[model samples]
Target: MLCQLEDDWTLFTLVFAVALLVPRSPLRFCGLVAALYVLWPAFRFRQAPPWNARQVIRPAGDTGSPMVSVIAHRGGGHDAPENTVAAIREASKNGASGVELDVGFTADGVAVLMHDDTVDRTTDGSGELSQMSFFQLAKLDAAAKHRLRDAFAGEKVPTLEEAVEECLKLGLTIYFDVKGHADQAAAVLKELYMKHPALYDTSVVCSFEPRVIYRMRQADPDVVTALTHRPWSLSRFGDGIPRFSSLWRHRWATLMDVLLDWAHHHLLWRLCGTSAILVQKDSISPDYVQYWARKRVALVAWTVNTAVEKQYYQDVLHVNYMTDSLLGDCDAHY
Candidate 1:
């Protein structure tokens, strides 16, 4: 409910304006106080960014503490099936320093690694994940449609515990990408951290939803958190809803996107207590990077696949990046 209010910039602006401009003195004073409370988080800290760039932790097996700049997107989906244990293993075997794992819940409340709301795209099943139990999910072949299906024919959907154990055993840094269920996810992560305290340094909980990060910090202040952003996300590349909607709805969504983009750049990071920002690869450049750097926030880019792009992110941008494959044309030599 709080996150919804924060994200509704249009409503807030209207309420704020009316409250301050009302002829009643009591309402104007209340409005002024409420405005300060909302703005407090932005000014509370002297340093804008929480994580120090110099102290960026390395994957467990690496020599000397040089940063692990290359991360496997969806556990190196190009090498194997995405979000499967096989994919995670492929990433480590091929020299990726880290892997990004998606977390979603089943009907039985089991947290598992899954990128989409449905199993149709990656598995042999054809239904919403929330409607399926862990038993049903466990029977489906997660790699059934992959190009390398023959090699990973029997891959099963891995639970969050299974994925985390595999990543830890392989000494790979983990990025837990939560898509929804903010409070439930935060509770699960808090329990995991309690069991494996090392995750405090080896893993980060990241989400495009600011509410997820906010809830995470509220649940466990010590957990590392990051905010993921892709400019014009809803207006352009998103789940197909906006594209199939009415023209007027699309225009309203585009306007909202612009407002949200400004909030992401200006207030959301601080408001959510994010340590880093995971930006879409296309929006990254020297100037954009400098803007975040001036405020001391470490920037990481996503879906950088080509060798040239990898090299540029390394040599030119000097930032960490996530890629689909750790082999073929996208290999990054550690």
Candidate 2:
């Protein structure tokens, strides 16, 4: 709740600051225009029903397959320190078919498990992951910042190689959420997959950046890949303005999001050789679900935490889904 309030405040301040740049009458007009520009799309989408009438097309040789795989978001985040070995093990124990973990590079180009650019939020240390060497990161306790720190204390950040070894040993599927440093990360993934060819059939490489997914396809066409999507409303600018990021300061993030959306809606998956589409839960509708299913593109929903939402996606939508919690409806057939 506090975070939400802070986001709202930040957004308001940004708008007011911009408005102050204009003359009085034009300022009021500009404010009104901005309000409409932002709110109109959200209002329309909320009132609109899920698109369900479009005819789905499947390219030759493509076939629809029913998939009900249970994926752990951040490797069962609620049950363990996310992106750690403990979380991977717990997800497998909880019956998850696979685990999704984020990958980033340290200062020395060592690939490690991390969702944020900085370790401040998820570790006892305070510093950018990209600025710290792996040796430096190795000393920080990764689990100290988790809610169940006592249970997972002393858990150090695991390297991409270590994570792969653990997942392979446990016979669990690995979903690599490429955060950045795509080229470097792709090299690490390709090397590991080459070492264990069996992973080719069990692992998936997914990311919000199309270039990253495209690069992975270039590295190994046989490797399964997915493109993640979030609707404009749920995007970085959806709830409130983003103040701290360089992307926001330059105002290019929103433009990139628009282009990405166009690509997703236009079936860019075919060109990128992606076998799946990972979408935000609320942004999905019956239409696109059926459409993707017909295209032989597996659909995966993310961060679904509530039982009702889980049942709706699994039972009604009949698509694979990822969840933060390892308990409740999410645990039913994991």
Candidate 3:
């Protein structure tokens, strides 16, 4: 217990720092107690040995190439209808080493590929995604809202099973991005990994929520896992919760972001036994890259689109990244 506490001393330090911010002595005491109670699980955590991330995320058929490995964001959303099987195939066709796809459960509890809580954004259908059955989702055209809709018309939202099969068939690595439904998503992944043990090598489950990654490890420790983070993400307009309107609300968000960032950097990785961090592209820097390198954590940047940006990540950072389109800017001579 003492050894564990020594390793996680930073967590207690952060908690105490947050507690000290409460103006009232009685309330601060109560809040600190409550916070410690809530975070007790972290105190008991013993990190598992880190996975060999380079091997796990290596592109299929890779012949010791030195170029940065690229993953298709939402299965190359910019070129194909996002999250559809068509998009997955498009990613493979465009030479992506892997595809990052979102997974959400339907009203009937069937796992399917989707990004938003509602189908309004990606499909012609207008309704809550969680309220719709898979049968209903199947009928909606996923490509309806895309600029290239005509080219990819009649594309149906694919099930998680179908997405897995297609990715495995194409020898593409899979990054299952789960937004919520921790237990259910973990159960589904556990089943998939059981059936396809190779997933242990070629895939990872990632989420912004630590509980989701915790659940994935609980369900099956063999499955590789990563945590997604965007610094100041909690305060970002339209990205986190609704904008922090008032000054106090904004300040509170800033504080929360600091704590969250600290946890992402220190506390949660150890607790979750994460092998990598999928960070926003803008946050990647030499200092940041070197820091994680010291910890032996693989860094993967997301949504890198421009030719210049891709070249920089490849030649400078020399790290893996995800892009919205694997086609455009890909043919440029670096």
| Model 1 segments more than 4 A misplaced | 1-39, 42-68, 238-244, 330-334
Q: After superposition, how far is residue 130 of candidate 3 from its true place, in Å?
A: 0.6
> How accurate locally, in lDDT, is each candidate?
0.81, 0.74, 0.84
Which parts of model 3 have CA positions greater than 4 angstroms off? 1-9, 12-52, 58-67, 238-242, 329-334
RMSD values for the candidates in order, in angstroms, are 5.5, 12.6, 4.7
Task: Please report the candidate that would top lDDT against the real structure.
Answer: 3
> How would you encode candidate 3's per-residue C-alpha lDDT over 228-270 as one tens digit per residue?
9988878775345546678888889899999899888877887
lDDT of 1 by residue, 247-299 (tens): 88789778988989887876777677677889988889999989876655678
What pairs collide in candidate 1? none
TM-score of each: 0.85, 0.74, 0.86
Query: Lowest lDDT 10-mer window, candidate 1?
Result: 44-53
Stretches > 4 Å off in candidate 2: 1-67, 233-256, 329-334
Query: What C-alpha lDDT, on a 0 to 100 scale, does residue 328 get in candidate 1?
Result: 49
Worst 10 residues of 2 by lDDT: 47-56
Error of 2 at 37 (Å): 36
